[model samples]
Target: MLRFNLLLCFLFLLPGKHLFAQNQTGKRYKIDRYNSIYLPLGEISFADKLVQFKVGNPPPIKKYRDSTQCLHEPNYRNYQTPNFISLGCGGTLTVAFTDNGFMNLPGDDLYIFEVGPSREAAKIEISQNGKEWVYAGKIAGGKSSIELSDAGIDNETVFYFLRITDLKELCRSISAGADIDAIGAINSVIKLTINADVLFDVAKYNLKETAKESLDSLAKIIKKVDKATILIEGHTDSDGDEISNLTLSKNRSISVKERLLKIFNNYEGYDFEVKAFGESTPRFPNDSDENKQLNRRVEITVLPPKDYYENLINK
Candidate 1:
């Protein structure tokens, strides 16, 4: 059975709370925050979903098998408090970034917060889709960060899944293998999701009158960035005809792009791209009304500034 955090999983599914935007400071040379784009370390920035967890040959006791401990931010004390999960002798764990994904940054792209003094090692792999993975190097207990810069992946690609398999370097004590506190995508983009119901009327592509205020406020935040690429993607529920749904999704994305562009008409610091996935990319199954509502959304993804990234790469 796949172990997961019930509360954390439920909270992330709520509308407007799905994707978060990070607050970038300085020259974008260094981000002070972790996985979340909207909030800092104390907030909900880390991984939210625990896809798979298999205890190693000599697994830890039942108390340490609680996978929920690895859900949010890192909170492991130096052998004082037991706030992390143990991956047994040679167990494996896989996590999903439901809110944000990490991309190919110039520096380290991922950080694994581990506990214990033995410094157990785990082989790390990342994937855009959970089925196909790319070797992303390894992280020993203390040496917890890894870079995907040399992973032979396109810089524009973003990865959402991470699979960690213990190397079985150490198998002593109740908390065997690698003890994990949290996983962070250091080089990630800001994601903001808006519900389609709030943006438009049923079966219509025009912007709702009430949505202008929210969009305007959202634009104010986007305006603060020095330089970036903004992506607008539209999605729908599987309730309608596939072709019609695709067209609706496309039109809705264009509508949002037009409004945002008008807001940024005089500014040249941002570039925009639009995509429509229709019912192909649903956050939840469309069996219920609530799930359908969640599926119908317009996602706005903001990548880090190009100039800062290039400078960091050359450094």
Candidate 2:
């Protein structure tokens, strides 16, 4: 009886083979064209079965995998220090030392330093005579700096110095050596000396050809410094009506600016400010020819803003 039941089961499985063969019939399939093989019906079969595995089913994967197949990483850590300066980089530095051997200036002469490799900590020091040194402070990375204003050194013919002290355990090694990359000293402020009489034509808003020489000199002074600004002021004698004088003075100031623009060829980054006082701010009583000449002229003064100058020094 058991053998008869087994035969019945085998017969039941035969129909499944016929069904799989029917599903694959008339289906043009190619596994590999280069090596073709025609598979006959009943040669392939399908089975539905339960799959079981031992321990170690994974907890849900927390991170997605990157499949780009690129194995290299960027080398961003090799970058080192960049160059910078505090005081003497963009412009010149002037130290005003009195005859008595002290810095008489009311403000600080601050400077910026670009710290470099060797990881050695550094400090700045100042010297009045270049013999004795006073410790300023520690300098870290780029833009670290010190100021001489709070040093309270005397205003005599003083010499300033910067000493870089290495504080790293291995001794800091920079691309540059231990010496300062630059050194500079400040000089006394030089006031512009202008003669108004030579600056313009008499009773006219135009600058005289003779005044070109003076204007050229003024331009030279301006070109010597960075971020310098100019103020062109116009004044007139009391000989004319007050209203006419005011208008003339204003025109004169404008004319000066125009001439400067022409002379400088309208430098893109530079600027000038123009103003007219007319007969308001007189240099003299305007009674004598000399006094009238002084009043009739236009004055051009070059001034740098305190903050801007300080920034230049500290940069």
Q: In model 1, what is the error at residue 65, expressed in angstroms?
A: 2.2
Each candidate: what lDDT? 0.76, 0.43
Candidate 2 lDDT over 122-198, as tens digits, reads 45565554457776555454433344554554543234333444333322122222212222222222234355567
The lDDT leader among the candidates is 1
Error of 2 at 287 (Å): 2.4
Per-candidate total of colliding backbone pairs: 5, 19
Model 1 alpha-carbon drift over 4 Å, by segment: 1-44, 190-258, 261-300, 305-315
**Candidate 1 Cα deviation (angstroms), residue 178:** 0.6
Report clash pairs, candidate 1.
21-37, 21-38, 22-37, 22-38, 36-45
Q: How much RMSD separates candidate 2 from the native structure?
A: 35.1
Model 2 segments more than 4 A misplaced:
1-196, 305-315
